[model samples]
Target: MTSALILENLCKSFGSGADAVQVLDHVALDLPQGQSLALTGDSGSGKSTLLHICAGLEPFDRGKVVLAGHDITQNDDAAGAALRRDTIGLVFQQFNLIPSLTVAANLAFQARLAGRHDPDFTTELARRLGIAQLMSRYPEQLSGGQQQRVAIGRCLAARPRLVLADEPTGNLDEATGDAVLDLMMELAAQAGTALLLVTHSTRLAQRCDSRVHLRAGKLQVPA
Candidate 1:
């Protein structure tokens, strides 16, 4: 089967020769459709950098990144933005909801941008996330957990081929985090969206289809 996301011999660094710090060295990954892969590492281990590369938000020095059969490494910023707008969903720890837009509007924002807006799907998704009641309220009106639920909803609104979550539950307490994870997994699976999750929580990592640990810019199977 075709992989949902792939990275082969990926390399990345910051700065020029003298001050350059190699962040990723020959990293590789293959995430299949409807599967979740957890990325774990210590601070400054390049997990976020790797996620950004996969998202096509950051360019790498060498190697390949393919998403849903397209070579994201080859895309220019405009193309990358288009790809990200259409094919990928992102969930961040901070729950980057628009304070200005109402919950309903925020949820539909990206879907609209992708030209795939579906009011029916958005309504159903909100209902599924248990945020249907808050549709009229602004993000600031919700709790952190509620904001996160909205963020997750927004990610799924476009029915993206892949979902990249960067410590999605980091801002929540253990119980809330677990709850959010359950909902995220359930919803992503229901939509057949592949998941690439970056997290420091071993429990969260263990919940994915597989776990890969990062250290000093390299990847290893959890021993």
Candidate 2:
């Protein structure tokens, strides 16, 4: 079976000449279906950069990144956006929920955009996230943790081939964070989606199928 995600000699840099700051160097890794991989690194270690590059929101100067079956490193912006819309789910530190839309609408947004909307899946995901009762409610009406659960439901409801989360539980307290992470892991597994999660907490990272560290712009299993 094809890997859900593959990074081969991925390299990225900013600026130019002497001022050029290389953020990613020959980074490589893989994520298979129905499993989670934790990405842990110090700030400025390029964890988010790698995520953005993988998501096709940013371009790399070297190497390749394949998402699902597409080679994202070769795609232009339009193709990248399409891939993101059709195959990828991103959970950010900020909930990023639509303030004007009801929780149900927000949950259905991406799935609809991908032409993969399933009312039953949306309902089930909302229920699993513990936000089914809040479906008709607007984002502002919910607490921080509630909004985050809605955000997670939004991603998983789409049934994306790969789920990329960058500090998804960062804004919540420890207990809430743990609960949110647990829900995300369980939902992703149920959907058979590959997950690449960027986090700082070792306790959280240890729960994943594997853990990788980013340093000097490379990814490696912890020594």
Candidate 3:
């Protein structure tokens, strides 16, 4: 199967010289299309940094990053933005929904930005996420779980080739988080989007097709 995301010899650090802190060291990974992979590590383990690099939201000191078959290691700001607009979906733990927009509008925002707005698909996603009736509600009016459902709906609305999620369910209780994750994985599979999820839950990580652990700024065998 073709890979949707690849990282080779990736290196990243903060600051410079003596005060510099290495975050990623020669990290390598290959995530095949239409599959899911869980990335697990302790706090400060660089898991979120890795996801950001993959999404072109951050830069690495040295390495190669390819998303949906396009090399992004040397991409300029505009190029990186274009790559994200065209091929990547991001879901954050904070449920980054636009407070000014109603749930329906928020759900279609990313798709509209990507020029892939599909009313039929958006409606179906809302129905499946159990947020169809909340379409007219604003982000601030929804509960944490509801807001997250909208966030997931918005990300997948763009039909992106790859989805990067950073602790998407961290705000919810265990049962709610599990349910949200189940919905996310199910929808991602239906869309055939490659998913790289950064999470701390062992049970959640085990639900994915494969798992990778990060330690000491390098990829380690999954524990």
Mind giving the per-residue lDDT tens digits that candidate 3 earns over 1-223?
Answer: 9999999999999999999999999999999998999999999888988988888878789989989889997688898899999899999776879889999999999999999999999999898778999999999999888898899889988999999999888877888788778878887798888999999989899999999999999888675
Q: What TM value does model 2 have?
A: 0.93
Each prediction's TM-score against the native? 0.92, 0.93, 0.94
Off by over 4 Å in 1: none
Deviation from native of the Cα of residue 173 in model 1, angstroms = 2.3
**Considering summed lDDT, which 10 consecutive residues are worst modelled in model 2?**
123-132
- What TM-score should be assigned to candidate 1? 0.92
Query: What Cα-based lDDT does every candidate model obtain?
Result: 0.89, 0.89, 0.90
Which window of ten consecutive residues has the lowest lDDT sum in model 3?
Answer: 171-180
Model 2 Cα RMSD, 1 decimal:
1.6
Q: Which of the numbered candidates is closest to the native, going by highest lDDT?
A: 3
Candidate 1, 2: how far from true, in Å?
1.5
How displaced is residue 34 in candidate 1, in Å?
1.3
